[model samples]
Target: MPKTEKSSMSWLLRVIPWNTTVVLFALAVTAVLLLGVHYYMEGLISIGTLFLIYQYTQMLNDPIEMLGDQVQEFQKAKSGMLRSRELLSMRSEIEEGKEEQLPQGPLGLEFSQVHFSYNPDKPVLQDINFTIKPGERLGIIGRTGSGKSSLSRVLLRLYNLDRGTIRVGGTDITELSLQALYRRVGMVTQDVQLFDGTLRDNLTLFNSDVSDHMIKETTDRLGLSQWIDSQPQGLDTYLAAGGASLSAGEAQLFALTRVFLTEPSLVILDEPSSRLDAATEGMLQSAIDQLMKQSTGVIIAHRLATLEKVDRIMVLGDGKVLEFGAREELASNPASHYARLLITGREEELA
Candidate 1:
């Protein structure tokens, strides 16, 4: 049976004993009342008085039954509270050190002999080693579970590596404060999260210091100025939860705009165009191109069209690198995994 069904059954079994106890206790109380009536007032009590006594006893029993139910609900609530407490009490995986410092300016990244896993026995990234030049735009491609997303997580210091080191701007990431690392790296994922606020609030994430001119300039550069102007409220327009007023593509574009305002040295796009239609993908592509021009980009994409302008491509399989080189060079070799992917894409396009 499913685990949920089994758990429900177990809970029912626990409550059964308590319910049975309450039922037996109520019956015992009723029997005692009858015995008292028989001994003390066998001939004196009227039929009406006996009926009233029985009715009062039943009224008392009803509250006892309700108490048992309340106890069961309390038990469930306590269990949930304890689980939440356990999660809240755990320490963060990323640690801050007193002596570690971060470097400034555009940052290049290097992953050397990196290995990590959510589980100790099952590694997610194995012996990964690669370097990205300052301001280089890299395209990463692989099948599902090939560790494409994991790379971005590691760069942001979201998870510590079980082995090896990651360097940003020539300084080891582990040696830098978690705050410093995050300030330098940004990521845009497939799922776009928008808060319930105005467009400008979402873009600046409620930071009061970002000037209107800066926000407008970045939006214009990303080709979103035209759309923003068409909106009735423009930047002041209110957004519902998850940006309900906007389409998925519009939400993602808004998310991109938010990240652009930060001006991070490294940007990771984890399949930013996957959910978008062709027209939206084109818009996303154009926005991404502009964003990448000023920062080092690490794009994790499935579509070859998205990788056309990338400086290099890294293809992974089963947590290992299959090929890593210039996009043109990798696509030229028929035996290369990237070349095979391109051929497959072309065939699918024709069909």
Candidate 2:
């Protein structure tokens, strides 16, 4: 159906009934008042009885208005349910792979001849090719919509590529089971979701197997021990849903702690410190540096300064690799995109 027509139809569906009910209510009240006045003037009813009839007419107003409100609410709920069911009934694009486990240790990652798009005509990634050696850190710099986050999505198999292969530790990711793939590859982003639960439950995601000792150890490693200690109930503290009581930085720390527990072979940081304040970014940076040391890391950042610890840098533009080389090489070359961004102080301006 045409979107405009559909929208008009929906708006009419909602507005028409309410309007009709309001019109009917007004007419009924007017008729009651007119008749009550006439009956009182003709001595068929007393003034007190006329007033009582008017009061009774007014009484219907509440329920009539309430009925209109309920009708609108019911329509909204019906539309939402249909959408939810449609989503639920859709098939997954990804086909489960046969391999059950990823290789042990920091896994090298490679992408070859990759292309992807949400729509056929507008590609988000095009012929992307790169490799990160096992245990090496790669910082990806790109403007918004430059496919930085899309790379992470494909790496985690959230979306199947239109073409080409992604290999981790020499095994094609398409051959790995979704469970095994996710277990070995992890990504942390700026937005953190915290449920209404104790700090322990939020951190462990209610997993009983994650021992208190391990949680404590990870917290200590991430330098979050002090923060946790300051909490009124420490690990036992009950957090409001959506991390309402936690600052943006603290919520990110929780996200890092959860990823740390997974002990992924490859960790991707998708602008984790973007929303953080200077002091919190420093703390997050410290935690990230420590995390990077233990796994194959991919740091996606808008600022070049964030890539200081990276071994290599990849610059992307318009879904293509604009530059990819050792960080030192790119930084020293004045003609390089990375060098130009540094000289112009436009690193943070990229996004």
Candidate 3:
């Protein structure tokens, strides 16, 4: 027999012996006998005796049922404990450091000889190197699985680098505290998660430092104030689970509002307009343009049009940089991959 079949047979055999079917059959037989004795042969056994037998059988079955439930709960807890142990045993990726601060204004970023892999044997990013000047806007584009997202993850220090260093504001990112790193770098994604609270709570993220004036200012900038005003209670309006009440574009705008309030030195936007309709995408584009004006920005976009306003573009292919330079320079080169992408994008639009 095949190993899988043998394992299945073994599991069946183990389970068959401990099943409740046999006990239930025995109980049924016992109840029938007691019923017959009490009703037909009334002198030999009384109804009270029959009732006592039923009660005793029920008492015997109750603990078994309870035990089955307890066993299931125990299994669940055991699985949780194993996962917790695994997490606790793993060490943090961020190195110990006292540097808990970054530059006060827009910060530049540099990646030097960086390489990383989810599995050490299969590298996801290969010898990546790049630099973004403070307040510069760079757009990243690549085919799927091109390591575009991995670059952002490495900059955010979500995973430990297998080789090389990343510098933010002239200080090695790994040498900075995780909190400091995150506080200076912000990210916005297409799928925005809304908490179960009023609109104000979702916008401010329960941060007391965020003032109503700031919220109003940012919302106005993002063109979200009109939507807020349309609400019956404005900021006090309650959003159901995952903000089911708001449209997708509104939720995304709310996420941008959160990022704006933070005033981070750098921002990463991962296809923020990819899933939106034409009108919503236009709104997202405007908001993104405003965001880029305030901070150094890296935009990972599939659509070439979104890169029009960026200062530079980085094209990746198979986890490697195919081209990196000024958008205008890359666009003028018909032989370049970015030029091909733009031509293809334009062709698709016309088609």
| Better candidate by lDDT, 1 or 3 | 1
Candidate 1 overall Cα lDDT vs. reference? 0.81
Candidate 3 residue pairs that clash: none
Q: Per-residue alpha-carbon lDDT of model 1 for 1-351, expressed as tens digits?
A: 776985687588658866886878778777967765895476777767777777777777777777777777776786677668978999986786443455565678899999989899899999999999999989888777888888888878788899999998888888887777778788887677888988888889899899899988998999988778777899998888766788877777887898899998888887643356777778788998988888889998766777898989988877898789998898899998778777777422211
Provide C-alpha RMSD values for all models, in order.
4.5, 4.5, 5.2
Off by over 4 Å in 3: 1-91, 94-96, 231-233, 240-248, 273-275, 340-351
How high a TM-score does candidate 2 get?
0.75
Whose TM-score is greatest here? Answer: 1
Model 2 pairs whose backbones collide: none
TM-scores, all candidates, are 0.79, 0.75, 0.76
Clashes (candidate 2): 0
Cα-based RMSD of candidate 2: 4.5
- Cα lDDT of model 2 by residue, 125-231, tens digit: 99999999999999998888899889888988889999999998888988898888888887887577789899999888899999999988988898988888999
Q: Can you write out model 3's per-residue Cα lDDT over 201-308, one digit (the tens) per residue?
A: 888888878888988998788776886888889999998766678777777777777888888889998774345577766877788888778799998885665788
